[model samples]
Structures are given as structure tokens and as C-alpha cells.
Target chain A: MRWFNFVLLLFVTLVLQLGVGRLFGVGPQRVMPDLLLLLAVVLAFRGPADQALIACWILGLVKDLSSQAPLGSYAFAFGLLAWAIVRLREMFYGEHPITLIVLTFLCSFLAEIFVLFICSLKKVMEVESYTSFSLVIMFSAMLTAGLAPYGQWLILKLHRQLGLPRRRIYGR
Target chain B: MAGRRSERLSHKQIFTYLMMGAVVCMLLPVRVTNHLDHVLSVLVAPFSKGSQDMSLMVTDKIHQDDSGEVPSDTPEEPVDATIQDTNRLVNIEQELKYYKDLTDRLSGLRQNQSLDRARLIVAYITGSDSSNQREVKFLDRGTRNQVESGQIVIGWPKQIYKDNILNDEETDAIYEQALSGAVVGRISDAGSWTSSLQLISDPGMAMKVAIEPAPQRREDWRVKGILKGKGLGQISVHLIPATVPVKTGDVVLARSDDEGLPMDMIIGYISSCRRTEKNPVEWQILVQPAVDLQNLREVVVIKR
Candidate 1:
């Protein structure tokens, strides 16, 4: 049942990343929502850190292969995010919607920065001006944060339907 | 405890899984990967096509509404006849001039030792995708039309209608001259219905280029550069030194030294240029291609 939820989440994450995410223009800076990061955050809040880590690795690999970016960049960023979210779980409660939104925003922002950093390091992309980078990050964070409540709600519904407990849902 | 034993099994299982995965990665076939990429591109194409169709439909509707204002039913016979007669006279004069020019050009071709015999095939660009890298695919006049690989394809020249009126004769002349450009690259691969034009923009594409001496009053008039494509709608002309007075507006044309034939075919103007201190022998020159690459729906493939 846990495995099924993970697979379903992966499918939904990819669909949203490619479909609805693309529908929303990336803006002049060409920054779009990091749906995979959002999924990782939501999973980290409700499931075990280990499962979130695995999901991140798998999804990141898929993203790397699908996109024009170098491999393993997304996986590293996502794994770190999953670990951080799990460690912070004791300090924050997941029941609050605003908390979820903020967490999603922070994680997504970090993921984007990490990707940009990786690309630069790989010499695949030149670094944009600091001002442009900041604007893209701010806008992308706000957009992803705004959409987090719906993402959380979907995850919660799926968790319930699958008869999976909020705690101990993902094995450590 | 039972937990410890289960944990040990899990570790062993993971190890086995990782080993299997590594082996699979090493053994994966290139053809399988290419097929997967093709399938993914096909899946994504519909989304882009739908957006394109929507935009086109809106534009078409606006055009139809605008055209509705014109009185289409009005019978302007006398005006039409006058226009027709004028066009006929122009056509006769142009034909006589064309033959005379052709004769001169033919003689010049022989004297200049250039290849003059050629055939043309019209083609349409159906779709483009960058899976392995940026690639453009085209659907050309089929095998029945004798279209083959290594033939140069060029955009159909804009039809210059006589006074915004397109008579059949003028239209034919425009179509005939559609494939007059220099051969940059050729059909690398061919099929029964479609042939792949390995464009001059391909990374593997290589072609010889000749530079014309700069106009008088320019001290650095050494006019020779090789135009190489950097892929993704970017091209660079090499062998031009910083000392050469090449400016942004300077035209980079494809020139062949064969006598009797037109020497230079205009490629595009230089958009930006930079001199590399590390490479004093050459300057990196960027050229904005004259071809409207994104909108290339049809082209004429010429064999000479």
C-alpha cells in the first residue's frame, strides 16, 4: 500500500510538472514551479524521511534524463531537502496549511538554486545576474507556495483512501 | 531480535538490486534509448501543436473578419482587363529578357568552369525536435520526383507579384528560382516519402567558404571565412582576423569561384563579432541566418 502511494505520487508529480506546470508560463526569466520538490516536501511532512529520499532519487533521475540538464543534480538537491525536512519535523507541525506552504516554498527555492548551481558547475549554463536570479527565485517560490495547499490536500486524501496512517507511513 | 534478521535481509537485497541495476545500465542498447526519446517527443508534440493551432485559428478568424469589409462581389471587369493586358506585356518582355540572360549566363558558366545543370524539388518542414540535440526534419517531394540525398534545399523565394497581382506566369517563375541558393548541406538520409536534410547548422556539417576582398578604402580587406554552425540556430564564421574591418552589418555570403555562375549567394549578415586574444589568427563572428528556421514549412531542394 505504501509502495502504491509512492508510485501514484510519482505519476501525479510528473504529470503536473510537465502538463499544468508548463501551462503556466515560466515568465520572462523562464522559471517554473518545482512540482517534484513540492511533492518531496509533502511526503516528508506526512511520511518517513527514507521513503521521501528514495522518491527524490527516483524522480530526480527521471527528471535528469528527461530534461537537458546534467544527471544527478536534482537527486542531490532533493535528497538534501528530504533530509532537512525530516530533521525539522520535530520543530514544526504539519497540520497547519501555512506551515506546509512556507516549507514547500523554501524547499522549492533551494531546489531551483541547487539546479542553477549544478548547471553552472557543469559548465552547461552561464550564471545570470544576481538581480535576475533573485526575481526568478522569488516569483517561483510564491507560485509554488500558492499551489501547495492543493497539493497537500491531495496527498492527505490519498493517504486516507489508501488506509495509510499519517505516522509510520514510510519506513525509515 | 526478529528486526535484526529482517534488516540483514533487506541490506543483502539492496546490494543485489544495486548490482543488477549497474549491469542493466552497462548493457542498455543505444537503439532502445533512441526509440524511447522518439516516443517521448511524439507524446509532447501534440501539446505544442494544440497551442500552435489555437493561435493560428485566432489569427485566421481576425483576418476573415477584416476581409469581410472589402466588397468581393463587385464586378470590376474593365479594371481587371487593363491589369491583365499590362501583365501580359510585362510577361512577354520579361521572358525575352530571361532567355537572353540565360544564354549569357550559360556562356559565362562554361568560361568560368562552374556546374550549371540543376533540378529543384519542393519540400515542407512538418516537425522539429531536439532529442539527442537540435534536429530539423522535413517532408520533401517524394521519390517519384527523384529527390535524393546530398541535394541542397533552400527556402522558396518570396513571390514578387506585379503590382500585388499574381499572374500564373510570374508565379511559375518565382517557383523556378526558389532553389537558386548555394548548397550548404544535403539530404543526409532519405526515405520513400521523406528525406532528412542534414542542415548546414548541424554540428557535423562542414562546407568550404570563400571570402570576397573588402571594398576599396578598407585596409583589412582579406575576405575569407569558414561558416560553421554551433547548433541551435547559431553559426560562426572563422578565419576572419580582428585586423579585418568586418562590421556587424557586413554580409557573409556563400561564394564559389567557378566562372560564368553567380559568385556569391547571400547567407546572412553578421549580428555580433568578437576577437579572441587567445586565438589571434581568427575572430569569432556570429551570424543571424537569413532563413526563418522556425517557420520553414516548405523548401526547394536543388540538384546541380
Candidate 2:
């Protein structure tokens, strides 16, 4: 995909995350899925190397910009997360909804932990308890993962319609 | 084959190095990073604000529809009548208070200090700080709205009614109850057009809270205590002597602070009460917030 198209996609997803996602209020903070990170995960598994990196890097930067957290926090976390997911792609089947769900869930969980660690190192902030926060992280992960299949499917279908062949995602 | 393998290995190394570079960049001077963040925020604000408005409109519509569809309950009418009677009594008490205030003002005996609701700015919460599990949210209003850090944000909750039947006499009471919605949180950070609020559910956050006296009580006996959030939907009130006539079902209100939150602002209702495990002498009270911290849409920020 052209770089401009990818950037446009990122912008649209960020808007969705900020606006439409807030309407899905399951708790005090709307328990909406993290669309930017979700898109990053989608690209990491299905897109070419350059596209995946650009998506992760841009999304992470946006996350940092929009949040009160320190800069580069999400960039590093998402970058590492994408790297890991790309490396692990060979171990599991890539096309199944269950695989995508599990991958998204695990990536989200790991990403939260990594960002928490970085924030702590910088003395940015501390939560009351990790045990309780873990439950929230788990719920958010599931929420993100629950929508993964559809997101990835749509992107993959769009790429196919554009005459981009489905590259062997695993071990590529 | 070896050449391709080496190329792939180099690609992985490049990825690792790039990740490391990004992490290292985070260690730059805080001031520099903050400036960059500010620049980015300027670019992101308009988009965030636009989306927040859309979300708020949708949520308001949903609440409107829900309000119209009368909920069903067992033996609903009689229960509603009972509630209505209770509300009527409370309304009478409020009317008495209003007259007393009027008389006091006429005689130069007293003056109310709490800021009027109209003076407060209504701000939309745009998003949550998802980096950590800390209960923080970003608001679309910031310094531009004269919103400052430590200003209290309040959620005005709708009163729970048993049935759809509207009572003519108690209609004003419903409006009164709605206005009495509890304090949701305080502004922890404020930008030019955006801010962040820390919820009362944050573990270490505390407030001076009290249980308002029963309507039937002739004596003004409010039990005051310090309430600290214990995370996970629980707040523990501290320094409450076991002897205090506090109990479950009593409505909790902010104990003081006429600026951020007035003494009369309802916080939540007491869900359970027990003696502290460590102190044994003081009471540990759990409050279920008057507002569902989950479904907040519009909130009033008392300008500090």
C-alpha cells in the first residue's frame, strides 16, 4: 500500500478511537477498543514489512501525543510489540479468527505491561494496585481482540480487491 | 540460501535497533519532550474535540430514549407512590430551607457562598489515559474554558424511578435530585483546550465525606469522615468512630470545600459499613457512587 493511504487509514482510526469509541460506555471510561493499536496489530500480522513498521510507529506516536504520558512511551511499546508479533507469526496459523483473537489479546496485554514499566522507570505515575489493574487490562485486551478478526478481514479484503496478492504472512 | 538467511537476520537486527532507538529517545530531556507533546496536542485537539462532541450527542440520545421507555417493576405503582410521598416530604423540607435562607438574607444574617451552577463550565471527557490502569480521563475543555487543575468535575445522575407514571406534584423533586448528582473527580492536568481528570476511584485519592442526616431527624447530625478510594469500585471512609450513628443506605455528601464542591453536593450512598481491620475503632464504609462512573456523558466543571 502507498504510504499516504496508510497514513490516511491511521488518521481515520484515531478519529474513531477518540469519537465513536467513547459511545460504547461499559464503565466510567468507555471500554472502547483501542483502534490505533488494533490497526497496528492488524498490519503487523498481515501487511508488508514497511507498512507494518510505519503503522506501528505512527500509531504509537499518536498515542503518546494524545495522552499525558511521556513521549516515545507508546512508540517503543508498540514497536517492540509489532516486532514480537512478527517474529511469532511463524509459530501459529495466521488466517484463523481464533489465532487473530489470541494474538491481539496477548499483544495488548504485553503492550500494557511494557508501557507501565516504562512509565514507572520515568516516575511518570503509579497505579494503586497491579492486581486490580490487571483485570482491567485483561478486559481491554479482550475488547481489542474481540474486534480483531473483522478489522483484519476488512483490510485483507481491501488489499485483495486492490490486486495485492495475499502474501504468505507466516514466515515471510 | 545462506545469503537470503543473512538478509532476513539483518532485517531482524535492524528492527531491534529501531525499537531500541525509540526507547532511548524517550530518555531525552523532559522539557524537550514536553514541547514536542504540546505541539502534537495542538494538532490533535481539533480532531479529538470534534469526535468527543459526536460521542456526547449519541450518548445523550440514548439516555433520552431510555428515559422515555418506562421501566417495569413488581408492584410498581404503590412503590412509586411511596417514593413520591417521601419526595414530597423532602420537597417541603427544601422549601422550608429556601424560605429560611430568604429570611436570613433579608435580615443580613447569612449569605450562601457556593458557586451557582450556571457559572460552571460544561466540559466533555474526550478519552482515557490507557497507558496505565489509573482512573484518568482527558477532557475537551482546558485553560480556554478557564478550567484549572484541582477543579471538581461533577456528574448529575438521573433519579431512579420504579414506574413510568409521572407524578405532577413530585416533578420538581426529580429535577432537584438530578441537580444533586455526585462529584465524579478532579482535574489533575489542564492544557489550553484539553485537560485530564483523576476519578475518585483512584487508589490514593481521598475526600472529606459525610452521611447526611435522615429527613426525619430534628437534629442536624451529619457524620463526617475521610474517604479514600481503595480502587476496584470501593472507597473506605477513615477516622469514623464506631460509635457514630452511620449506617448503610445513608446518602454520602462532600463534607466541605465550598469552591471545588459544596458541602451539600451528594457523593454517593453508603453501600456497606464495617469496622476497620487495622484500627477496629474506626469504621470502614463502602460507598456505591450516586453516578454510574461507567456511563458519564456531560459533566460540569466548577471553575477554580
Candidate 3:
């Protein structure tokens, strides 16, 4: 039951990140911020690596299907993000809100640059448009970083409700 | 024993994930088919409607504010009898002119003795996805209406008949008015419930056009051309040589092959013209279409 709820939360977060976040234009240049990337990072740092991989795969597929870009682009970028986050899991703890925000900014920047690189290589978009492209990515990253602390608070609350062990710093 | 079980479970999980990814990749291209496109369009229609409603609300509010400031100050006086009488005489003259024009049009229709006759079906456009998928869902004009493919549809402009003449009776009238035109592309693939009307502005559309020199340049009227659409709300008339007497403000119309016509069906006037050096015998002419294709809701399909 707890596992199901976690998966559902991840799914809803991904959808909101793409749909509502896009509609509100809260991200970079009014583009949608990568909520799925943030979720994957959080999960990799705190939850099982296998679950993080699965979440990344599902979220990437959904984003690709909904967006105008060619398929497999988001999937490749997100899969790499999950792997990288998992590799860096030993360096940071999930309890630190500031660390989570900084990690989100860096991951989002890398993911966006990677997407732009792939798009340019495929001749889908011109390299000159990268100025506007970078603006949207930077703004989106800032917005996502701003929301990271709130997301951590919600994660902690959900963890408690699921009867998961609280961090030793926070009493159960 | 426990370690072996855990390893087997991990292998099974990897297989499941791989299978899922493979299935998603296969289905991605398949989802872009016509059926899925139509389904998604229907889903997105409501969002478009909401946006339109918001714009309308803003416009209506502005109109209300403008009306409040400019109240009519003139005291209502009964119209003068002499003025009314003069207006009545002018109205009769206009009616006679209208009836004469209508008679000529009907006579021309009767004289078309071509064996390759085409049929027409009057249909209303219910929905359209830009210039690409324009489906005209008629109000069940019935099978007897002979609404077939390749039929041309033309919208009749509103008729304004003189009130005093003919006791204000509604008579078929023809005046200088812009009418929307469309050709039937295909019938509904599923059922006879609806038919698709290919708009003139459609990318694949091509039609016969004829151009002549303006009346002012009748003495030097050595220029003639053909008009062709370049899609996305633009049209160009080609083949008029640079040395030929073609200029801006010259009238262009869909020339009828039928003889003894007093006036040509005016489509639009040439807005801009440029002489191409590569083709000295042709001038590139841009035309603003007379009929607003975007706002057209209904059109008449004339039998060819």
C-alpha cells in the first residue's frame, strides 16, 4: 500500500509539473520546469535506486508523448539524470533543503542543455535560438529550486504517514 | 537461498521494465494517426472555446463603456414627407436594377449546355482545424440534395431589396457583394452524417483564373495573367510581363469563358506588383482576397 502511494505521488507530481507548471508559466521563460527530474533526484537520494530508475522512465515517457519533440529524447536525458543522482547519493543527505535546491538547479541546467544539444544535432531547431532557450531553462531552474524546500516538507509529511522511519534528526 | 531469490527478482524486474519501454517506443508513432488526431482535437476544443469566451467578455466590456459616454442628443422628429417620397423613388430604381441583374444570371444558368454538369450541395462548416482539416457538417440536407464529392459551394451574400417596390416582397437579388466559395473535397469516411468542404485557401487547391488590363489603360491593354494561391492567406497572379501595362489597383476577377457578359465577377484588386528579372514576361502580383475565408460559416455550392 505504501509503495503504491509513493508511485502515485510520483506520477501526479510529474503530471502537475508538466501540465499546471506549464500553464502557469512558473518555470524558465514561462516554460514548464522539470518536476520529474526533481522527483527522480529526491527519490535517488532518499529512496531505492531501482524505484528512482522506474520513476524516471515513466515520467520521461509521459513527457515525450505529450510534447512536440521527437520520442526517446526526454527518456535518454531523464534516464541519465536518474543514474547521475543515484551515483551522487553518498555525497548528500535528503534532509538538507538547501542541498536539494542546489542539486535541482544543476540537474535541470544539465538536462536542458542536453536536450538543446540533441535537438540542434538533429536539426530540429537552430543553435541561434539557444539564447531564448537558455533563458527559459534558467528561469525554470530558479522556479524549481524555489519550490524544492516545500517539496521536501511534503516528502517528510508523506514519509511519516506511510510509517517510514523519520531521519534521526527529526523525531518520529 | 535468499540471495538467489533476490537476484532472480531483480532480473525479472529488469525484464519487465525493458518490455514496457519497448512497447511505449512501438506505440509512439502509431498514436499520430488520423483517428488519434481527431480524438485529441475534440478534447482540446473546450480549451479553445474558453479562450474565445474570455476575449469576447473583454470586448463587450469595452463596448459598454464606449456606449455610456456617447449618448445620442438629437430629439426624435418624424421624417419629412418630401424626403421619404424621394427615398421611395430611389429605392424603386435600385430594385429594377437588381431584378435585371438576377434575370441575366438565371438566363446564363439556363444556357450552360455542357454535358459534363457538376452538382452543388449547400453545407455549413461545423468545425475546422485551420486550412488543413476543414469539415463541413451540414444540417442533414438529405441524400436527395445530391451532395457529392468535387461539388463547388458558394455562399450567397445577404440580399437587400428595396422596401417600397414589390411591396417589400423578398426577391432573388444580385448586387456587388463578396461571397465565400469552397469545393467539396471528400465525404465523411465513416458515415453520410457529414461532408468535408475544401476551402479555396487550402494548400492543394488550384483553379482557373484570368486577368485583364484596367479600364484606365485600355489603349495599352497588352497584359494578361493567371492568379495562383501560395497558401497561408496569400495569392499571386503571374505571367503579366514587366513591359505590359499592369499596375497596382488593377482589378482581377475569375474570368468566365461564357460570352456576352456585361460585368466580370470581381475577386480582388492587385495590391502590390514586382517585375522579376529572371522572367521578363511575368510580373509577381500580390492580391488581398475579397472574401474573408476565415470568418466564413456557410457557402453555396453551384452546379458546374
Ranking by DockQ: 2, 1, 3
Candidate 2 stretches greater than 4 Å from native: A25-30, A68-70, A118-126, A160-165, A169-172, B1-112, B130-132, B158-179, B214-219, B230-233, B262-264, B276-279
Per-residue lDDT for B138-187 in model 3, tens only? 22232345554444444321111111111111212211111121122223
TM-score of each: 0.49, 0.74, 0.43
Candidate 2 structure quality by residue, lDDT tens digits, B1-304: 5555533445446556667767777887544665454454455556765776667556546655346653445354455345434444543444455456667788676444443432467665565554435556666677877988778877654234212212324434434443545678888767786777777876546778767555655446667788777655566677778888877766666644545753245666678888757878877778777666645555667663
lDDT of 1 by residue, B55-127 (tens): 4345436644345653444354355443334333322333454456567887456533222233445555433
lDDT of 1 by residue, A1-172 (tens): 3677677667655544543343343542234566766777777777655555565556655554444344455565666677677677767866778998888888877776766665555544334244555556677777778879888787777886544465534234
Better of 2 and 3 by TM-score: 2
Write down the C-alpha DockQ for each prediction.
0.11, 0.36, 0.07
Native-referenced Cα lDDT, model 1? 0.52
iRMSD, all candidates:
7.5, 3.6, 9.8
User: Between which residue pairs do clashes occur in model 1?
Assistant: B108-B260, B109-B260, B112-B259, B211-B223
Candidate 2 falls in which docking quality class?
acceptable
TM-score, predicted candidate 3 vs. hidden true structure: 0.43
Model 2 CA lDDT for position B255: 49
